[model samples]
Target: MGNKRICVPNKKEAPLFSWPWEDLNNYKYLLYGPLVSKVLYSIYKEEINNVDTWCLHILTLFVLRAFVHQLWIIYSNMLFLNRTRRINQQGVEFNQIDAEWHWDNFLILQAIVASLIYLSFPSLANLPIWDFRGILCCLVLHIGISEPLYYWIHRLLHCATLFQQYHWLHHSSKVTSSFTAGHATFLEHLLLCIVVGIPILGTAFIGYGSISLMYSYLLVFDFLRCLGHSNFEVIPYKLFEDVPLLKHVIYTPTYHSLHHADMATNFCLFMPLYDKLWKTINTRSWDLQNEISSRTKSRVPDFVFLAHGVDIISSLHAPFVLRSFSSIPFSIKPFLFPLWPFTFMTILVMWAQSKTFLYSFYNLRGRLHQTWAVPRLGFQYFLPFAAEGINNHIEDAILTADKLGVKVISLAALNKNEALNGGGTLFVNKHPNLKVRVVHGNTLTAAVILHEIPQNVDEVFLTGATSKLGRAIALYLAQRNVKVLMLTPSTERFIKIQKEAPLDYQHNLVQVTKYQAAKHCKTWIIGKWTTPREQYYAPSGTHFHQFVVPPIIPFRRDCTYGKLAAMKLPDDVEGLGSCEYTMGRGVVHACHAGGVVHFLEGWKHHEVGAINVDQIDVVWKAALKHGLNPL
Candidate 1:
């Protein structure tokens, strides 16, 4: 029979055997024979003919077998306990309400009950009904009875009324630790132990059984019970699917934990037979639930504006214009057709007319014929026309320059493919008065090209949003004495470039004081300076020139306050300043009833832009002052 020891709490001190380490030593004894084996060999050598020596050797072997069996059980228990303690100490609170009580007492009760059932089997042979058939019947009975009985009692415990008061406590711990397997109420433990034991014992009594078989089964069962509670995740359950006999066995740790976690399901305790027979098996649910929970916890919204920035440039603005032209009607579109018919005829006529008629009407006090010979200065214009906004700003700047006979240079547009190619130069021959170049190269090559440009290039007009290329260009130009004009669709990018501009410049490039430096001529333009294409295109139109208003140039000061606040202006500014200003060879003049004077002053000083007006005002003022034509 297997050994049994009662553990009374504080009533008697159980022998302290150094626990886990002692368990390891016992395992060594099993693998290599015990110290008594050598002594027995010596005895056999000294007295070869003695009958007592043979009997002693037999006794030693029996003792050794029992010791090894008990030692294996103790070792397995030690492993489970050690793992449980470590997990518990990690501050991993098990949701199970009665975790402490169950871990300490439930397994002990089950072990005791299992031992009793095993020991009781030998007594069946002593009874009046003893035969070979009876013994064979008893072995089968013991093996099959406990599992079904355990299942029924387990199912009953899952009823709502019983679960809330008792079973829920066992399932509260979400992450099932080693010790948590046995963590359940004492009454629940007692019910499981008694219900399972009665059936197995009843069968053992009905059929006579050998005590030794009973002993071996019980010991192995207890050892396996401890193994099931071990934290080691070594076993692969998939390996058992092909083994017909082993596949039907009771209580794999994996299968059992699922039952404890969700009592409403997986009611079978020892085997999945009842679960499968009743159509209650759900092996994949636990993993599925875990996956879904993780996904839910990490969910991110699709329209997070802060992370990706406003889609004004690509999604909202560009699509609106593209769709408007695609849907425009054809009847009234001929009136908006180009008057000129050559390769560059349409563009040249658009530039000349916009300057002579539209610009003169807006800026000059007199009629166009009288103001035809008026002298004007010239200024650099950076028009970013690629994705969200169109090339209308370039058209507008050209018109203004042509009316005043100012010099203009158009930068070639970089498309998505060209930009991605990362090494090439694009040349446009359409406008003889303008020099248009597009840089399509790797960042280092682009940087090198920018560095080669002479420092004497006084003012720079930059178009496009804050990209790595754009930022690098701004930083490089700022290091020289060149003034920068920045324009973009992204407000965040605009803000970031503004902050990085000064630091990016060379430290000793200019030793001028802050006031003098502020007046040292620099301009950055940003915003929807021109009217949107949707305003001009018909719902089903086919032409690109039908885009309205070329592009509008508002002084930065005009839009800095109230509805158009690009960035907040200082409170001291009262109203519009002057309507005319000069920079380089250009003269910028505005007729709007806003802060045109501040814009003009900013143009002369080469300020980033008038805080309240469109940046186009700076370009106009600069061109008019320098006596250069955009055409």
Candidate 2:
């Protein structure tokens, strides 16, 4: 939520649900309870005949719930849409969306589901609407009977073979949309219906259930599912807190979201009790739910976005060979190192690795003074022969973050190039056990780099001009009417970039294919440098900014770069003292800063593909405020 200072209990001791009355601040949300009751009462009126009413009511049940679901969404959005995203998951909340597909699917299934279970005669109107015993019995019978069946059946579907063939579709939207609730395979959909059908239909034949109770249960059931998928949590949690046991008996929207987010956990549908008993509950679900339930109109959002730096293999050769060689009992082998055999071996390793980069990640815990972690994904180097390995490294890096429970992650450089799904559809499709969200942090990086440019710089020289980030920056400068000197190894690529530049800024280009064209420029951007070291050079006197991780800082040893500055902990980070990092700050790469900015801004869904000019302005403003835009 955009709110600041919302109190969240320490996760270690936090309960699954908070006490509602204790939340006096959000007690206003409880006001909607009566509104909910009033609307539901009107929808579930006394029926004329039990038989026709059962059929009519069964169909009416879905529509009534759909109406309530939509109304709840609109009502919640009116007050808390921007303040909170979804029912319980953190970061930016979604706007009211068309969940017609969810509605349509249910409608499509309504007739089939009704006929299959003989939903023709509901219990008569003899049972009072306020008959508390009848309602409690209905609620419990459903929970007791349906959830255990749903749990085991659900768990069975997760068996490796079945999951890939059947369940992946339902798990597709880790971040649920309304349709997400209805997005499972038709078989899965039928099973969902059967779970509830047993309770509603069983009451009709048993002679004690009422149309009111059936619809009420059905209505509440739909509302909860929609609530689980809507991505917003408006229930005053303290109500459950006051009734302590209600927490275990009820499931919140966040609880269900955890199921979709990370499969293989939270198997029970109605409540987590079965999940708890079966030990199938996700470890992080409760604490995360409490974190969301604890939100108020005051409190900064606490979402962590992870990122990583990747380098072309050639760049790491100098470091990898230097380190590996040094690590070898160098003191004992000092004489050997200078000899022909050792020297020849070192050069050979560097040569072979010149094409591929190493595979590893470094944790950046305290550098940003916020909860941001980046695992710079790298590979052994380029083997024009084995590019697939690099792709695997990126995949491995993503799985690493997801398994660790990161909520959102940003892909940089080649990682962005390889995994820039319009909505992360690819990763969602490929990684079934996936949980973490992905963002191409290109937007904020665009913002920071643009901010780093000194006002005196007019003409810009950009290298690797055809790369994803490079292309974005080039277009942005063109949009701003700034002249650019484009240099890349490919003439075709440079020309393509020139054509892509807006017509108004076409004359602003000093387009050149030769590397020498970058000479004498006031501003230079080493845009994801991928060229061999011997072929790349920076203009010594110009203000140069490198955006890649482990930056091309040594393009020229004598050229000055931003001095690495150490961060002062706890004091700079508002008492989060456990964060560990040696103080250092020169220019942290723009990609890392991009991840940090998303964490600070509470933007969980601000997934950028190619950072646009507008995003640059937003991030630039934030970077300046934080003093992270070092030139």
The lDDT, on a scale of 0 to 1, for candidate 1 is 0.34
Task: Determine the backbone clash count of candidate 1.
Answer: 72
Candidate 2, residue 399: Cα displacement in angstroms equals: 42
Model 1, stretches more than 4 Å misplaced?
Answer: 1-98, 101-139, 142-144, 227-232, 285-631
Among all windows of ten consecutive residues in candidate 2, which has the lowest summed lDDT?
A: 91-100
- Model 2: runs farther than 4 Å from truth? 1-55, 75-103, 116-136, 235-242, 296-631
> Per-residue lDDT of 156-275 in model 2, one digit per residue for the tens?
989986676666656644345444566555567667778877776566556556657776887777777776676666555667667867666777777777777667788777677898
TM-score of each: 0.29, 0.38
